[model samples]
Target: MAERIRTLTGHLVRHTGKKSPDVQNVSGNLSPAVQSSFRYTLENPLKTLTKNQRNFYEENGYLVIKYLVPVSALQSYRKRFAEICNGECTVPGLTVMKDVALAKSSPIQGEKAVVKIQDFQYDDALFQYCCLPQIIRYVENFTGPNIMAMHTMLINKPPDLGKKTSRHPVHQDLHYFPFRPADRIVCSWTAMEKVHRQNGCLVVVPGSHQGDLKPHSYPKWEGGVNKMYHGITNFDPTLPMVHLEMDPGDTVFFHPLLIHGSGTNRTDSFRKAISCHYASTDCHFIDIAGTSQENLAEEVIDLAVKRTGLPREDIQFKDIWTLKSRCVKGEQNHLQGY
Candidate 1:
């Protein structure tokens, strides 16, 4: 029945020998409510969502909701997605640009994607599904109220020829967005494809989120800020590395700085996912690298101009935005495209 359910749990072949490492002094402890939620992990294997299973999301930055969007919702989104996707006709963001010259120039596997919707700056589904009630309540269960929408994105990795697998490297996401200590920023990835070990799904190092988020070279995702990979690594021989085994409509939520990456898609099908990052309104974007908080926000404006939409209010960064340069020249994006 587990096999029939198709949610296979396995460790990474490369890291198969690696065990979960233990810490002498855990950097942080899980809240009681968060710890208790793990008890309700999905038992049916094919179930949509389980209350107890939500604990992982609280303790860790992410959780996997089996069958998150029903097949009907998924199909409906797909149809609308297709229409929006068609509009791009091979612009920078849309993968379906395959039918166009630039997209045709680069093939995931000789097949070009006709990206209808290009990047999150334009994609709408992210707001519709990424901030789902179930997802919001999941976070509210821990962080309480005053949650605010941070940023949203839709990745149209076209079938056969996509970036997620081959070109995609490992990295921590939160490092891209600076947040205060008390306020946490969370991200959720919803699979529009049958994400499995065979087709290059998300792989994460459990408990790794609690450690130093290693510095990495900025990755060149089609629509996202160039991101870097891990902060540190010390293999333990007990706990196992796991792939975010997921299916269309299944959603996985993780922390801002979780060390994670995916393998290349050597398969024939398309792998589509929607990622949304949320931060509590109470969570302030701070920069602590300065000697004092004085003029810190102003000093970083040139640096953070890339991260527009950030409120003009003063902030004290808790993480180093300079860990990796926000040198992204995302200037030519379709901002005012009609």
Candidate 2:
């Protein structure tokens, strides 16, 4: 146990530049169960990931698997997206959000005006992507057998309108999640079309998931930031970053704490991607009352109250998540906190 403590201490010091008081306390109180859950572990005998792939994910916090999704699936999703946007179909509980810049100005009609749709778990066609056997196989490796699709989105990054409102600020996904043992959570993001730097493909800080979740706030960009598009306040600009340029049907599975964002779409077309955040059913909700996430929780609760016409006192951050999440694999367990 002394050797283990030393190793953890060294890692903490190296990443943080000094040993944190919280780490010191945790080291002294470390338990075997807690230590085991400190990071993601590959299943013995392995399910879908090769040893090298598992190692890469452990070291880099993300793995890009080319052609994990098929072209046919991507086409179907695109068709369904257009149908929804064109008002040919309505997806109950799905929130269609327009680009802030376009919404402020003369809004484009039909599908072009919509920038994204969130919580589409109710839409069977789009939800099918979450249940693809290949995706579930990879997701089980990170989240174990029992999985819950905690959040879902089909991001349509519209072309920049002079203002760079299309650019997403660098932030950790965990900042918006109220959950414990973040290692059990992973996000699967697949490109619907060829994505490159010009179209604002994903930009990730390699291995940034090894650090703790930082405080987040809306960036003071001259162009108005999107609602709930919070950014890491202290992200080091000098950190080496990788731009993930992917072809259609390519998917990347990344840790929730990995710091990532995309650039503004400089092309005339929209950059589209489908993503879902999955977590182990064993993971439980966490209270954000005294943490950096409190601000986000409050904002989310307020938005829920306004949208549903529910009393502010009756809405809770966890309740909102519970309503949005659905079991994609295995049996639903702890995440149902209403």
Candidate 3:
């Protein structure tokens, strides 16, 4: 059955204009030959990235492209976010989350109070970011022609309210994912404004993607940690970190295993960015139980129970991801199993 699935997936990729030689079998454990063929970076010809750019990503686990998004489009997204916060618009399946510090303190209303919005695939305006031609062009280089936008977020890093709760803990993105062949997944984060250290820009450890997924849990901080904000328990503090200060429309595409986090927003305003995690439709979900991802999966299931008032047994972790994922390009093959 597994071999049959791979054959069908390979045929699908060929029909979609992607070279079959670049396709990997999506079933069972990857053999050494397959693993060697699908390196951290693609060896085949790229659609948008130059050879130097591809080499940079291979060595550093990330690549930054300046002015990859239009300022006008970002402004439009900002307006839509404000409308959603002000209760002027409703988007089904969207989650509006407030900063943990602000949630405890005096209630500040509107967009300023909300820290981020998740699962915005149902919102046409914001979801357009995932389908941007410029983005997909680069994304196809990493995830191939058949792609699925597995996750979406518009982060609003609110100014710290003296508690330093606005800072996200350093962790790997794969900690929250239950997918295999981690090389097939990539995240594109675009700044919605000028982001600097003072305003909590992204801090990344270069070449971290070559490492294995580390164990993670909530960091112990005086200010309460936000729901689902897990941190690497054994993160090597001595490892060199780079602060990614980006202007509006500057975008970075990174591997899932890259260790990264942001500083507190010391500035008085919000630091905003939009991002989507894309994976090859050829990638398949894995059982996360008894693994480092188990804790997060349990938390997500618990949250689902509270939100939907459903029986705990009915809401599996994979089901949550299956419902959230949407195909951005080509056929949705292996990833659709719920």
Query: What's the ranking of the predictions by lDDT, best on top?
Result: 3, 2, 1
lDDT of each: 0.46, 0.81, 0.83
Ranking by TM-score: 3, 2, 1
Whichever of 2 and 3 has more lDDT, that candidate is: 3
Query: Looking at candidate 2, what is the lDDT of residue 306?
Result: 65
Using TM-score as the measure, name the better of candidate 1 and candidate 3: 3
- State the TM-score for model 3: 0.88
Across 240-269, the per-residue lDDT of candidate 1 in tens digits comes to 567888878887767766777766666765
Cα error, residue 144 of model 2, in Å, equals 0.1
Residue 144, model 1: lDDT of: 36
- Looking at model 3, residue 149 earns an lDDT score of 85
- lDDT per residue for candidate 3 within 37-121, as digits (tens), equals 3376553343367878877888899999999999999999999999999999887667899999888876799998899999877
lDDT (10s digit) by residue, model 2, range 1-338: 23432332232122222211111111122122323432574463333688788788988999999999999999999999999999998765678888889889954877788889988876778888888877877887788777788899999999999899999999999999998789999999999999999989999999999999999999998979888899999778999999999999999999999999999999999999999999988899888999999999999877776676655666667767776777776557887511
**Candidate 2: residue 227 lDDT (0-100):** 86
lDDT computed for candidate 3: 0.83
